[model samples]
Target: MAYHRRYSRPGTNRTPTCDKISEILGSADKLAGEYSFGGRADTLPPTPGLFVNGVGMILLPLVSEHAKKLIAKCRQSRDRPNMDMGKSWLQSDQVEMKNPSWQAGMEKLMKNIARGTGYMDIHFTACLTN
Candidate 1:
């Protein structure tokens, strides 16, 4: 999860703790991504590590200690996320977005994430079971 908003627009839900929108991106079993941007209710801007999935510039704790541990583990492991897989996944979505600005913004955001995480590519497919 990650969040870094100083102020929220009107009509949005207000929380006493913070006004940011915390996006918890995770798979069925574990969390996703190590972020250097948000880890607290009050992480200010100028965040160079403000991206979706990548090598984190610094571990600011996207969600919890688990995330930090996972990040460290992945870093140490020889296995790395497949860049092409993630790009394939996002290509269609980007086209669907239609708006040029939105598309560009998303690309930039993901690029930042990738850069920060040093290869935050993700393309997960799971078998379901109860």
Candidate 2:
């Protein structure tokens, strides 16, 4: 008989927490590289211990902690239904047409068009036709 280990249930949906942690760590590594000696080969220290301590001890753990907190927050939000805001403009497929700023801009544009052309209504109708 063989023994196997299973961390999660067969049908449970598990979030890729390790992947998120890896991604955060990867980004921190990239930033460390960029800021350290401008990623130059000659400027790098002779000992690998410097990078190991600076990145492994400091950056990786910091980023991992932040990632875990963010993941927890996301899970919490996902577990609850959003009840704050009204329907998004994308969901409703509608926008406010009576905004004061929009009306003012339209009026200014109409004045400019009317000044350029002799008639405002005719030019506006022609623009709509086009």
Candidate 3:
């Protein structure tokens, strides 16, 4: 007579329990909301599994929205220092400091310096120049 085992193979029962499924769905929804607003409250509802991977789904849309807001804020902060420096440069009659190309170049140079790969000749020129 052949023996029948009560336990099945690992792949035979790949489905998760209903409670586990609910927990996973909840966690995903929470992460989506937190990512959307930089750790803010989540307002979106739990996504149905069938439509979860569709266009404008949980991850992409939320991340995109968050990125847009963060980028805008960064731009504003970046411009503020330039504006202040521009005013000072104007007072000193050195209007070149207000040039857009110069500012862009300076920003790039500063980023390079931050990465420790910038030119040594480019010394720190100001106390507060972003």
Candidate 2 TM-score, C-alpha based: 0.20
User: All candidates' TM-scores?
Assistant: 0.22, 0.20, 0.19
What lDDT would candidate 2 get against the real structure?
A: 0.37
Candidate 3 backbone clash number? 0
Clashing pairs in 3: none
lDDT of 1 by residue, 50-76 (tens): 232342333344567545543443322
Cα displacement (Å) at residue 105, model 2:
1.6
lDDT of 2 by residue, 49-109 (tens): 2112112222333467644443343322332347353221121112133334544555555
Candidate 2: residue pairs that collide: none
Model 1: residues with Cα > 4 Å off, grouped in runs: 1-95, 120-130
Q: Give per-residue lDDT, candidate 3, residue 81.
A: 68
Better of 1 and 3 by TM-score: 1
What TM-score would candidate 3 get against the native?
A: 0.19
Candidate 3 global lDDT? 0.37
Highest TM-score among the candidates is held by which one?
Answer: 1
